[model samples]
Target: MTHTFEPEANKPGTQAGPIPEAAQETLPVVYQDEHLVVINKPTGLLVHRSPIDRHETRFAVQLLRDQLGQHVYPVHRLDKPTSGLLVFALNGDVARALSEKFNDKTIKKQYLALCRGYMPSQRLDYALSVKLDRIADKHKQQDKAAQPAITDFTTLATCELPYAVDRYPVSRYSLVLCEPHTGRKHQIRRHLKHAGHPIIGDAKHGKSVHNRFFANTFQADHLLLSAVGLDFSHPVTGTRLTLNCAAAPKFIQAIKRIDWQEPDWAVAIAPKWLAHG
Candidate 1:
């Protein structure tokens, strides 16, 4: 959670995490319209810049701004290390509308994650409030308990790596679908860790042994979680709007290496983090 990075006066982007000099156009636009825009954000690129990443220029907000040639506002943010669906508002009116929905827990979000160890067979509905690890706060801002965060998770598939993973015999991992009822900084990552199934490739809370294995074998270095789906009532149209995005290529590739299968929703109703904030 702690980084030794120092602030740079010349380059704001560089003070944050690694930022590409040029804006990334490769982010896929999953859904777009006059009021809202959705994109499949890439891993390793920040949604916005922080003090530590001040020198970096590559960010979701900036890229979308340049691509549209107008100002767009972010309704919510995803972790820089996580890739998946992201939503934006085209104007302040839309921003306020969407923001209200999110604050009221009317917006529904789903994420895909690969985590170490086995998850409970039953569905999980938990509330979490994270106290930001001061170490992650490069700006040295006021710190307090994060907003009340709630996340629900269901295990889709569980697989054990065939190869030996250090001292553990064939590390067990799960493909879980997460639905977050509340948005908090690093909510998914912190909640998964709290469940004792820290996400794979999450250097912050994940085991170093597992991270080394993935890095050595797959050359993957970011967290194995993605926000794949979101649903909410359109602020302007007053109609139901649902959006879904696919897992990033690297995450898909990693999951493909393991034996996996999807579960049938034959019955049951659906129910519904971090030190390095």
Candidate 2:
């Protein structure tokens, strides 16, 4: 069954009218089956409720559950500001199985990110300390050491704008395709930042000047990172499934404004696993 939901307004914390064109549209369902369903979650929508974003009314889980008229179990999540493919299991058993696949590194995830500097193709083998939330992980141990985090990335496209968003006369950027071998929280963003090519629109780790430039120039105000693809064996069917979707409209518009050609993997669905193979 096809499902849709009205996205949250562009301006956060307000639910009234005058929603942006993208916000007014329905949530795009990428793939679905008897055991599972996946949706192209728009930027700004929470995967579920949390104390961190207590004021937000709209959530992907609630919307998807209401739209599908069944309880859906979220196997994984995307950051609230990150947009694209999200998976949900129809039953608890499948959820556990899929969760195990993610825990065991059996499932592959591909992400597209627009970063501030031109990044080269490389593998980042860095470790990241656990980022605990004040409200959520307050009771947990705080002195845990950094865990291993690795990401394989390629610079798919690059462009230089004439405007000096930073100290340089010309602002440089790259479109990156990243496959994370480990699911560390914010692994791709942190790894890219460590490489000195932080993804645009990353508030915590990116340069504010370049972020403001994109917001004013292209009207793209959200994070430029998106989970574009997920490849895994279906929990019940035991068949390989490669699910893909394009980035959010604002993200694509920013890429076009920079005159970078969108790679086929960015917009087209792949029939087989193509990253980190």
The residue-level lDDT of candidate 1 at 230 comes to: 80
Name every residue pair that clashes in candidate 2: none
- What is residue 41's positional error in candidate 1, in angstroms? 0.7
State, as a TM-score between 0 and 1, how close model 1 is to the true structure: 0.80
lDDT of each prediction vs. the true structure? Answer: 0.72, 0.81
Candidate 1 per-residue lDDT over residues 140-254, each given as its tens digit: 5565454666688888778667768867667787878888777777787888888899998998888988888887876666788877778888899888877766676777666
Models, CA RMSD each: 9.7, 6.7
In order of listing, the candidates' clash counts read: 17, 0
Assess every candidate by TM-score: 0.80, 0.86
Q: Which candidate ranks first by TM-score, i.e. highest?
A: 2
Count of clashing pairs, candidate 2: 0
